[model samples]
Each structure stands twice: as C-alpha cells, then as structure tokens.
Target: MDEQALIPDSQQGDLNAFNRLVLAYQDLAFNIAYRMLGDEARAEECTQEAFFSAYRHLGSYRGGSFKAWVLRMVTNACYDELRRRKRRPVIPLEPLNDTDEEIESPAWLASSDPSPEEVVHLKELDTAIDHCLSTLLPDFRSVVILVDVQNMEYEEVSSILKSPLGTIKSRLARARQKMRDCLQGFEELLPSEYRHEQEGK
Candidate 1:
C-alpha cells in the first residue's frame, strides 16, 4: 500500500502498520543518525527512539510530508543524544577508521557486478566523505546531510530543522565550503567524476 494508506492505520494504533512505516524509513533514519552522531550503535538507538516517539505522537501529525515529519523526529532524537554525550563524553578504544570496515562495504554502494577496483574506490570515497563530514559542526553537518546527502530541498530542511530559510541556506553554504576544503585533501582517493565535482566547487 502507499505510505498515505499506512499512516492512518498506524495512527489508529495498528502495530503492523506502524512497523511497515518503520521498515520503509528505518534505513534513511539510521543513516541520518549515523551521519549525525558517527556511531552505529547510537544511530540505531536514536532511530528506534524516533519511531517510538512518532507512534506516540502520530495523532498530533498535521498531515503533509510524513517522511519530513519523521525526519524531524529523528533529527530531534539525534540532537538530544548529542546533548547527553556532551555531558558525559567517553573515548572509544578503537579509532573511527578502524571501526568503519563494515561501513566501507555498504550494499547500497555496490553495483550489481562491481569490479574489485571499483569496490576499492567506492570504499575510499565513502571513507573520505565520512571524514569530511566529521569535521563539521553538528548544525552545519546536519544541514549538509539533509540537503546534499539526503537530497532534501532548502525549505524542507528549514522546516525539519525549525530554522529560517536564510539560516538553512547559510548553514548549507558554510557546510559545503568545509566539505570542499576537506575533500580537496582526499582528491586522490575520490572517483574521477567525484574528484572533478570537488575541483569544480
């Protein structure tokens, strides 16, 4: 069924219907969390919490752009998590790059029949992008993730972030500039097309 059909059922306390929405959105939600927090476990936790919060608040949903509404929830959850972590920071024994072996092999990045060389290049590009994203402030990072990575429009991101459109545009501009500077350092690892795109920035 279409997502619109699922929403009413989910709003009526149908667990299965809500779960279908979860299945549809969890990957994108988790990716947003992961990109925001840079921790898989925390990302998973935030995604689950966002879903729970959504189910509870479903009645309050005023229609229009359910996906964007869900994203707003997940974004709030991530922000909350970030705030908590700020209060009690813990150092991980493993470095980010060391722990990202699995991230380097995401199924979404795979072609139906990717060559060994292509796979390696994809991994490198993913790592490079991740590193660049990590250097950004959380607010700037979130803007770029929503706009550039998640392919959201400026208005949608502004709505999700509850910020003004001009604020969103400014954050996106600064974030993109940061990423361009960061990516320039990793130009050799980027695919030719991506390298050209970066260079053109």
Candidate 2:
C-alpha cells in the first residue's frame, strides 16, 4: 500500500485509511514513546494521545515523510509528558553520571539470533543503556533515540524534531558522545564484543 495515498485520504476524513497508517507505524510510535518516557503505561497513553493529535492535525501535514510527520506528534506528546513529570519531582533511586564521546557504528544495532548466554548479556546491556538514556536531558535523549536507537537518518530526525539540520546534527553528536562516555563505565557489565563493536568508528 502506498503510504502517500493514505495520508491524503486520512486528511479527507478516511478513518479506515488512517487506521491502516496507524497499524503500520504504531510499533514505531510506541517504541519511541517507551524510549522517551521509560514507562510502559505512560508510553501507551502518550502514543494514543499522539495519534489522536495527529488525526486532528492531518490537514496541516504538507507532503514529506509521513513516518517523520507521525513521529513529530509522538515526540511532542512525549515532551508534554516529560514536562508534566518535571512538575511532580520525585526522589531518585539512582544517580546520574555525565560524560562525553560518540559511537557512529554500534555493534548492538546488528540483528541476530541470540544464544542463551547472549540473551542474558543483552538484558543487562539493555538495562544499562536504558539507565544511561534516562539520565540525558529530553532534547538530547530524543535525538539519540531517533538517530541511534531508531536508526533514523538525520534529515528525517530534523523533520520529526522540527529543528535545523545543523542543530539536529549537533545534538545527536553530543548525545552519542555522552552515551559513549556513560557506557564506558559499564564496560564490565557489557560483553567484550559489544564494547568493541564500534572500535574503528
């Protein structure tokens, strides 16, 4: 199915067409929200809200990447949630550690069938990654999640973020650097292969 056609149809009040588009991108939207907020239930709520917001504003979408357009709504929803969280501060169970560095070629981005040992290791690594992600400021976190975690290109990220290309690049660069530095402290927790995956890069 052509995604472009569905966009115009959705704009014209085609609920069925919009539903198809939703089915296609819901996982992406949810994952983004989950990554942004770090809470499953809140992520679900934000994703649903974003889709509703997207539907209401469908007519305002000029032709471009529909995925990015949908994602803009998702990010906005996530931003709103984060702002709410700020207003209701809570005591931290863990502390944040800040640092800097970049990883353009992350080995973890590779897909594969995992062995039992690999599976266990991956769970630990994921937790470490999530912890590091949670420490980042929302803007930096969004850039990293979209570019590195979501494997989106900078142009699409800029579109989703509604920022200048240069600004996106800078934020992503800083975010990656921060992640690289933060993950170094978890070198013992992560596998040898995972730690060295981006050596050349």
User: Candidate 1, which segments miss by more than 4 Å at Cα?
Assistant: 94-123, 193-201
Please report, as a residue range, the 10-residue window in candidate 1 with the lowest summed lDDT: 106-115
lDDT of 2 by residue, 100-193 (tens): 4453444433423333443455457776677678778999999999998889988889889999999999998899888877776566576678
The per-residue C-alpha lDDT of model 2 at residue 143 equals: 97
Give each model's whole-structure lDDT: 0.84, 0.84
User: For candidate 1, lDDT tens digit of each residue in 1-201?
Assistant: 589989999888889998999999999999999999888999999999999899989999989888889999999999999889989887434322445643444443323333444345545777667767877888999999999889989989988898999999999999999898777666677669977786688
Can you give the TM-score per candidate against the true fold? 0.79, 0.79
